[model samples]
Target: MAVYTELKPEAFARVSEAYGLGPVQEVVTIPEGSINTNHRIRTPEGRLFLRHTTVRSAEDLRFEAALLTHLTESHFPSPTLLLTKQGRPFLELEGGRVSLFKWLAGEELRRPQLTPDHLERLGLELGKMHRITQSFGGSRDNPYSAGQVRSWLAGLRRHKDDEVATVAEELEEHLERAEGQRGQGLEPRGVIHADLFMDNVKWLADRVGAFFDFEMACKDSYGLDVAITLNAWCFDNGAYLPELCRTFIRGYQDARPLAAVERENLFGHALFGAVRYSASRIRDFHLSPLPPEQLTRKDFRTYLARARALDALGPAGFLALLGL
Candidate 1:
């Protein structure tokens, strides 16, 4: 819904020619995400996905493009990056950087349609991605890590806004507890799609066909990645689905075995994952200076709700469901 930069037909046509995607027939803005501008462009050749954003540095853009390319080459089901005529992965347009991807075919599965089998397949894909990216040469530090969340909190405190101040104080306490628990155990590190929510994946024939949106990809604990998936995929109607959790962990372990430490502290990481996204949702949705129309604010309270649900199911209780 946020189209920061409007792309005229001529402008889009030029990009199409530059990328050898044939003459553009139509341009349609995708109104799903809040972060960047996305468009589905139709050309005589086929459909192409053009994403533009001024928020990312050229370095970050290059990093993302290269990561997607790597994923494709590694037999991962990700979008195919279209190269420019000069063979570049992206183009530096006047307004923002534009990257082209082949349109992936499939529909995103909604929560009501999700089953334990679906959760297991999602876990299986995540495990395969973790295994491939373990040796990936590229790395980006997580911008939404606990340290960054604290920094965002500090910025909010300086604002003198009461609501902002309240959120910061609450997040401060949660961040402190989450960070303390994070140091209790160390897990194997890899390039993780730090934000692997259901919406970011597409399903074909009731199975995962592609995993997209690597903008948050970074070098992090594989365990934390698993924990993030657990928080995102296992909860339903303010409750944790224990059978789904067990199926997910089993599927993840089917590809990459979890260490003893990962099993022992998995629930702690899930709590921190909850903290991470909740803090981010607050900062991005409420505190940031984005316009109300442009802002696609998510309910940060749901993540807090998820954290409470997880707390009810202690580490032993969570792992017991995982049959660990």
Candidate 2:
């Protein structure tokens, strides 16, 4: 329902012709995301997932295209971007840029339905992705680093709402502590899916179908990706699920073993992940100007609770919780 810019009939016709997809038969809006507009469109040829984004620059899109191409070459289970008749990865339209992907098959599982088996499979896939991308020559810096999140918190602190400002002030403290403790430049670096939440993955029966949503992929510490994914998958009912965390990390290490440095630095990375998402949910969902139906408002407080839990655990307690 986050269709900020709706496509017209003429626009669909143009896309169909440009991609040689034949006449468009059905167009269904995808109601999940917050930033970009997505649709499941069917033409005479087949069904395709169409994505339109005004926020991403051409350079960003090309980086994603290259990353996807590399993943495809590696035989990774990911969505394949279909080329236009001109062999371009994407098309420029009036309202925004559009990219069509051959619809990937699978279902996105909700939190309650996810099992330790699913986390294990997901972790293995993530590890494989990181391992595969180590040879990828393309590079982009992490956009949601500590410094960037601190800047976001600074802006949020000035908001008129007292609750938002208070939370932002608290988050700044957490960010400071996490950055101070983390050995910043010592971990193994690679291209990471910086936002690998559960919603970004798909499930086919008991196995992983695909890992989608590469918009936030960037070059960063490999440990950071593990921490971010751990935060996304292992937390439930206001607490971290220890068994799930253990299974996930074990699966990840099964593919590419974590270095001593990576293991030692996971605590700081996890804390930073909590702070980053909490602040982002505040900025993107809690304070969004979009109407209720257009965007789903995920409570920032859930991530705030995570930040608090991590702070209470400290580094040693966190490691113990993960059985690291």
| Tens digits of lDDT, candidate 2, 242-324 | 88999999889889998888888898898899999999999888998999888877989988988899999998999898878
> Each candidate's lDDT (Cα)?
0.81, 0.90
TM-scores for all predictions: 0.92, 0.98
Worst lDDT run of 10 residues, candidate 1, spans 177-186
Query: What TM-score does model 1 achieve against the real structure?
Result: 0.92
| Candidate 2, number of clashes | 1
Model 1 clash tally, residue pairs: 1
Q: Which residue pairs show collisions in model 1? A: 1-31
